[model samples]
Target: MSRDATSSLAAQIDARLSAPGAMDAARFASFLGGQQRLGLTHGGRALCRHLRPYLIAEHDYAAVARAAERIAAALERVARRALVDAALAEELGLSADERALAALDPGEGPFLTVGRLDMLVTEGGFSFIEYNADSPAGITDQLLIEETLMALPHLAPLRRGRGVRAPAPHRALLCALREGYAAWGGREARPTIAIVDWKTAATSAEFNVLADLFSAEGHRALILDPDELELDGGRLSAGGERIDLVYRRVITQELVGRRGLDHPLVRAYRDRAAYVANSFRTKPLNKKAAFAVLSAPEFADLFSPEQRAAIAEHIPWTRRVRSGRTSWRGRDVDLLELIGAEQESFVLKPNDDYGGKGVLLGWQTPPDAWRAAVRDAEAQRAIVQERSRARTARMPTFRDGGVAEEEVYFDLCPFVFAGRMEGAMVRLSASAVSNVSAGGGVTGLLIVDDPRLKREDNRHV
Candidate 1:
């Protein structure tokens, strides 16, 4: 859609939200209960219960499809780079244990594992910050919410468009997951799937979604707190049930810190007693250093000519920023000078943090804060990277009995199941931190139909 059309749509959305009084907590609770009866979990299901019908009308299918294709291609490229990086890490002695861990079979053990992706999309293109490669949420959430939205009384106009509606993302996700399992082994004897994460994590609803999807697919699914895990005789168990696969949602680093190597969960994972998504091997991809690696001249032989060109085109040129004294042009320079020189164009990031935490967008922060952050970066192995302006769209949200404007950025998470890129989960946020836990909202990505695109154009004319 054109800017005007998008603006108009935003207005419509705002008007709709303001048309009704703030939904009472009781009404919200009832809506949530209704969704639970339908087996939906996560904020996704709740949001879908309220917003799906509106979205059906709000989305333009053809534009979405075009966007999806572009985003998918970019993701595939990123995946290929990750595969190459994994190989390089192995050569560098950085990922030996991870390789061993990934080699374990799902059916051979009693533990479960999960995978995640941190993604962002824009009009310029989609770029993935990292693959959660360990534990990603919202699979179940995406489905339940979509289901609820489709059932809303307000969505008839959307339902009638484009002839046939798109399939539920949850169903698609289930199919992809089962296919991933089958590709690894089979479902002849159902694998005991568990959605594993912290009990108090804000996104626990994601676990519920995954559990429901697994159950619907005929797999015995359970949601377990990572703290409750146990290991015995080379098997992993949660709440006393043998776990066959773990849809891991916990940060491995956090897990490692809390349990040490002796924790039952760690022991089972290390012992290869269960299948883990993305494996521990996905660590390298999660490192901001990995972005630097993508730009290195030494790795030129590793990428295809096309892949090399694409990487060069899409990624910001990045480098490891180090501390200490160095001589340039026979003059000694300290860390402060180096940081000051590139403050406007660079972002300083800690190697292992996410959700935009501890990130110093040099231009956005106070000069003193930037200097302190840079000093900290020097102590840790923080990286300095060129900043790319993320594209934004204007969205209308209801607030204080009136329509309000917000700037939102899009994130496309293309789930890679068993090394193949499957479908996507799109997130939009008003803040730089697009994390759902940080108050970002999820939206249905519609691939615009050709007819609709033409209609949109005609309307514009």
Candidate 2:
């Protein structure tokens, strides 16, 4: 980045931090403790861990908007390409697991109707790190986290001075749910929407908040487990009411594992007895192999010029676990050899797990351990991605009864609905991983006096 640009960013951040309420760590912790009443706590602790917040400028927000468009396009291309030519999709490659998922009927919806794009901040804009269309868990929570932090008196100046506001993803999500009901031909003025997931899932709290939000919006919303549902005579009913729309939040594959895909919900969706926001088709793109399809040269022609450019610019070097010759930096290289040679520059992750499970950081592991992770990845159909340099910055965190300036690493995740960019989640951490589930913090969104930023982006919400 140019010196002026860097300094400009620093100035914006400083403006937010210069306030009195900027760094009360103890108060932040207490604030989190009070979130249980709001259903924002997880396992008895606040879901948002970072005390320091993100202060994004208007230009940075616009850049994220463009990045989201390109990402949505890329995901669409992959899903359509795979559908048009199953044989060609095979060439893009996958593990037996991902292949099976790809074969499943995704039903009639965008493969990734509602999901998130995890990215790293960069001078150019944002680096696409991972596409998470399958099971996006934290859209509402992210917004809530930001709002919770903004309520602090010390940070009140940032809101009053900069016109700070974070977009509510739950509102956009409701629109998508309503759209799904309409697609299912439901004529109810306000369809009964059920947030379907495992009864014991950690996100149950957010489900309650959503249910309340839906009630306020003129819809009867219910949070229930799949097992509690019954498909009697083709009508999927839950809690004694005929469900018109199902805002499915369960991991289809995992749910399928427990009860085959032919389960009532799956069958109901296929038969048009009900509607699912992210249809069954999203399971395919949920796999890590989709990244391989996005970055692999063999599949480059499948995407449009814009998509190809997005892949090249934002996506890092990535490949399926299988051994093969592939292009890297515009040239072909032996995949296994390169991975084995440069252990620190890579990471191995399970194609379908969440919450940082089965992820091995090469730089943090010993040589032997990295080799094991590489071999295991090949054995289980995993993905190897080049490590991204997620930027770090110093923030005032309350520690020991006073604000302590500490440096933290963070990542940006843009929430997309039907391939359209809506809002983003910011996860800050002291370590490399910035997932809230992995001890990261979420900060509020600030617009610096752009009231239109709220109204214009909020048309659908």
Candidate 3:
């Protein structure tokens, strides 16, 4: 589809969603209740229950697939090279533990398996803000919203006429785990699976959805907090049920190590007693500073031509917070000096965090506040990046029981499992910090197909 056509279709969807009696307070409340019924709650709060659906032109999804595939390839190249190429890993500024985790090798499938790249796509194209290559959230929350949207009466006509649809992210996750399990030598038709996470973590509620998905697929699924499981007598068991596959949702080694639970899982993982998808080795690539490595010219040779081009096109300028001189756009300059002089052109972020934690938007902050944020980022081992403005979508949603149409920033999260693109997690926020956990609401990712797309495809064929 042409750019104008895509824009027009998105407008039509937005208008329909905002149409009178399309979605009311009572209907929205029922949707929230449905989320609770599906276990889409984090910290006992209905996860993304208040947000409306995000529509995507199917052509845009295809473009996302092409870009995401390249990004995935680059990430895998970095993961693979970090293991054998010591010099490359050192340049990434990885901690000792991070280095080991990157080099430990999960043995099969993509090392950066089951990940998400948080990105912004506007008229020009999409550029990533951060990559959650380890333990990304919203896998089940998005699915729940999509299900509700598909069942709504107001959306019934649009769904049938426009070919509105969403892929099953949970189902893709299950398939990815089974592949990893078989690679680790699991022979059973239905392997017992455990969803591991902190007992009191906010995201624990999503575990029930995962458990149900596993069960529906003919496998035994158990939601076990890190402290509840143990490895003994040559078997890894949770609640006395033998665990054949571990879908790890917890990665904080210190917390799990304090109780000596990391020992069993790590040992079992190395000994192949059980399979752990996204095994402990994805820590380094999950860092915000990882993009710094990808964007640097020195590492260009490590990636293929296609990967390098995609990195340059879609990745913004990023560098770890430190006191030193560096090159920016081929010009040598003092890092802090450039940041201070061009404060509005940059954003600061903690290297390892989620839910928009420790993010400082330079464009939105005063000079004094921006300087203060820079000091904080330096103290916390964070990264200062070139700010990439996101395109806003008009979302017609309910606020205080009233119908309201507002321009909201949208972020597209494409999930990658075993190096393959699956369903996505799309979110909208009135603010630049478009994090679902931080009041940035989620929406059903609808692939709106049209005749123009099919015509273009036929010509290609």
* lDDT of candidate 2 over 24-63, digit per residue (tens): 6666677676566676665455755444466664545666
Model 1's number of clashes is: 25
* Model 1, runs deviating above 4 Å: 1-123, 148-154, 163-169, 183-187, 323-339, 451-461
- All candidates' lDDT scores? 0.55, 0.70, 0.74
> Residue-pair clashes per candidate, as listed?
25, 4, 0
* lDDT (tens digit, per residue) of candidate 3 on 390-424: 77876666787766777888888888888888878
> Using Cα atoms with residue i matched to residue i, what is each candidate's TM-score against the true structure?
0.73, 0.88, 0.91
RMSD of 1: 6.3
Q: In model 2, which runs have C-alpha deviations exceeding 4 angstroms?
A: 1-26, 88-111, 123-125, 161-163, 449-461
The number of clashing residue pairs in model 2 is 4
Ten-residue region with minimum lDDT total, candidate 2 = 452-461
Better of 2 and 3 by lDDT: 3
- Best-to-worst ranking by lDDT: 3, 2, 1
Please, what are the lDDT tens digits per residue for candidate 1 over residues 1-461? 23433344435444544455534445445656766665444444443322422122223333333333333344334434554466655422334444444343334321222234554444454344554555666555445545554444333344465533443445555555555555555444678887777887766766666676688778999888887888888878876788877767777677766765466766665676765554554555566666666665665565556556556655565655675554333456564576677687668877767666667777787888887777677557777776666666654433453445566775656554444343456666766666665566665543323334344432210
